[model samples]
Target: MGRLRVASYNVHSCIGIDRRFAPERIAEALLDIDANVVALQELGWHHRGLSNFDQFAYLEKMTGYHVIQGPTKFHARAHYGNAILMREAAHTHQLMDLSWPLHIPRGCILAHTHWKGEPLVVINVHLGLTPWDRRRQLKQLVHEIQSHRNSHVVLMGDFNNWKPASVMFKPLSQLLPECTDQPTFHTRKAHAPLDRIYLSPGLRFDTIKVWHTPITAKASDHLPIVADISF
Candidate 1:
């Protein structure tokens, strides 16, 4: 496969730092990134600020990409979680629950798609806040990656890992081996590498950076991280 561009963003429920709920702004940022596949976190459906409309639908329409939603929290009035937007069709997809009991619900979106006729497995996740919760969630994430050891895997998301040297990520470091430690949180003056991308062996990492722009800086709390990879 040739180079494929992928991006991960925490839309923060489409609420910007200015406290505005604008899905269009998020869509605009995604358009600017212009990635083949984008993994998004904190998408809301039927929420108050969103005017009770499905946020994913609006984004799908605006970005013109096929979407697969993995809702972790569901209620009578609201449903929100992670989702994947792909320029190409996904052969199959599923959701893996990573929720810690009594804590906010979390999940990962596992999507199977192709790039230049090669199978690519994309794992998109939004981890919990506490260290213990992230440790347990990472264990499950590693197991999932191991099961798909045969394919080209790209694991990208808001890992919620603030410490670049944290031992909690040791298992992932050993498995994926290559880690991008660029700051993506707090778009105004980012200092934490909370958002990251990991690749399976054999995939060449060409370039990676945080997609920072005027619109992205105000679109959400975290800026989008883009990466280009090939096999």
Candidate 2:
């Protein structure tokens, strides 16, 4: 394929900023993007937030894509963390346990996919909250992504880096000469650039936009970042 559209969104576990659970709204937002692959963060499974719904399966059904759920921790009926939804079955997939030594649980999903005829790796991450934790997580994250050297990489998710110049991102400086900052956090106002997508070498970018439709603003706390990319 010449280019595939990829998107990243923090769905806030399908809980809207208004405190209502509307998985359909999330689906609508995704439909608006019409992406080939999506990296989702802050997703919940059978956990209380989902009202016992299998959020992973639901998304797959809604978008007609295969899902790879990467749970950071298990709960009574489900787990919560990051996940990847691809247009086709993943060649391989793994979850990164990003829980810091003594901090909250977090994770990323590594799903190996094919775009056009090239092998591609999607690192779907939802990072830690505290500054201390994020620093360590970044280093660990770098190590994780670097291991898949032979494939074209796409790192995208809710990074939660409040500061625009966070040193925690230095580890990936070589890859981010130009970043797509659409300010996705706090969808109501959307002043924070917390959700992002980074593409590796040889991949080209045609468009980078925020899907901020009315429904999207109420679906989650963060708006979706959609990127039109090609290899």
Candidate 1, 131-211: lDDT as tens digits? 889999999999989898878899999988887568889888777877688999888899999999888888867999899
lDDT of 1: 0.87
| Top lDDT prediction, candidate number | 1
| Structure candidate 1, residue pairs in collision | none
After TM-score superposition, the amount by which residue 174's alpha carbon in candidate 2 deviates from its true location, in angstroms, is 1.2
CA-lDDT, candidates in order? 0.87, 0.82
Superposition TM-score, candidate 2 onto the true structure: 0.93
